[model samples]
Target: MKLKSGCFLQHLHLLLKYTACMSVRNAAALMEHFQLLDVHRKNYLNDLQFYCFLCYVTDLNKDKIMLLFDLLDRNVRGRICFNEFYTVVYTLLSHENDLEKQFIPRHAGRAFQLLDVDRDNMIDFNEFEAKRFLFNIQKEVKKIFKDIGISGDEQLNYREFKIFAVFCIDKQQKEEGDHE
Candidate 1:
């Protein structure tokens, strides 16, 4: 089903209602309930692992991820079920400090505008798939690499990429902290 940005945000709000109660296993089961287990299988696995690593590095536990999933899901339908999941993850993966400034609804709107190549005001589920999003992310990564004296040949392996993602999030948080 197609979703407008506002509708997606509402879904996240709805999901948040359950965050205080559900366990991680229960959350995973909820995902299964929505038939999202196989949605972009390889990417889902990678994202799950990456998310787990983020939680580990941040000293958060599975319960926190469950909270985050519920908080971000908005609709509480069990699955991410919308492109907004990308926005939520991007926000979560961003630095905590910059999260408010950079990933807030207003900023997210701008990000969406920039990414919506056709100006359709919505990102299709296909476009929201992790692989496709990673392709777009790679373009941004290339720019960052150039700034850091890293080359395309210095590609990040999976483990490295996970770390780098966390690092970037931390960096953004630091920048945000500095601003405050």
Candidate 2:
């Protein structure tokens, strides 16, 4: 579970390229769409296929897609695993959803760049606490943050956010009931 400094920094560098997102449900829909592509028989999103996928999933311009290709295409092998694809899509979708909800949607991405003060791509309790006042649904966002933190260390990593999003459906349903 521990990452070497070099690897950690490498990921940190890639994170700086982020700035937008969609919704978890849309992310799932994207996953399903990818699965049905019948392309990338090897289950890898390569340079050529990656472009096609991006075009299919979003209206992001070529330059931006190239930027994302650099970040999401880990290993520089000109390809991305499902996990990587999901990460990129989820990150974008999360941001998109937040925008729709008017929550951290303006700063770009699901979590917002402002939260990662240290620019390490992860949000610790301190960062979350510092920006707590920025969110409309403070309690809900905080609870989601806690639920997304799987390390038990109060740090919400990119991967954990994916898990958190998967369960947010229930949270939405609950919120609807409360509102009613």
Candidate 3:
């Protein structure tokens, strides 16, 4: 879907790491986790395996998984390919910003409020995804979270989020542009 250009490999690596942590699974285990053996597939997960994988993720429920599955099945196909799975995982889990959804309003205050969905005065991943329109790029959501939090806080207050909006993402884009 034309997400950030250089993010595919990095996000794929990170997603692999996350999967390993879920249950000590390696490449072969990953295939088995998605039940590749059952379906005689190389990298795709079938409908049942999709449900299992969703249950494997942290803090996820059936309803949310269904919603995500429906969205990722862009062509209404019954199965989710590995690439599609990666994109969905990246979207749901990664915290980096790739600028795929260009046009974050320059208004940092409103942006902060929108991202702070729980109204807990801080921004966490869940809240970030709620207003995901803010950074609809590749799987850089985690990186964005880290870059914005100067003090390395697990969550960010409005001030930190502002710094992220004002400087971090712009700098990131500029740096990416330079590399290209």
Give me the candidate number with maximum TM-score.
Answer: 2
Q: What is the Cα-based lDDT of residue 174 in candidate 3?
A: 75
Task: Extract clashing residue pairs from model 2.
Answer: 21-92, 21-93, 21-96, 22-92, 22-93, 23-93
Model 1 earns a TM-score of: 0.29
Order of candidates by lDDT, top first?
A: 2, 3, 1
Candidate 3: list runs displaced more than 4 Å: 1-43, 96-180
The clash numbers for all candidates, in the given order, read 6, 6, 8
Give the CA lDDT, 0 to 100, for residue 89 in model 3. 47
Q: Name the runs in model 2 displaced over 4 angstroms.
A: 1-30, 99-180
lDDT of 2: 0.53
Kindly report which residue stretches of model 1 are placed more than 4 angstroms away from their true locations once superposed. Answer: 1-152
The lDDT for every candidate, in the order shown, is 0.39, 0.53, 0.53
Candidate 2 C-alpha error for residue 163, in Å? 22
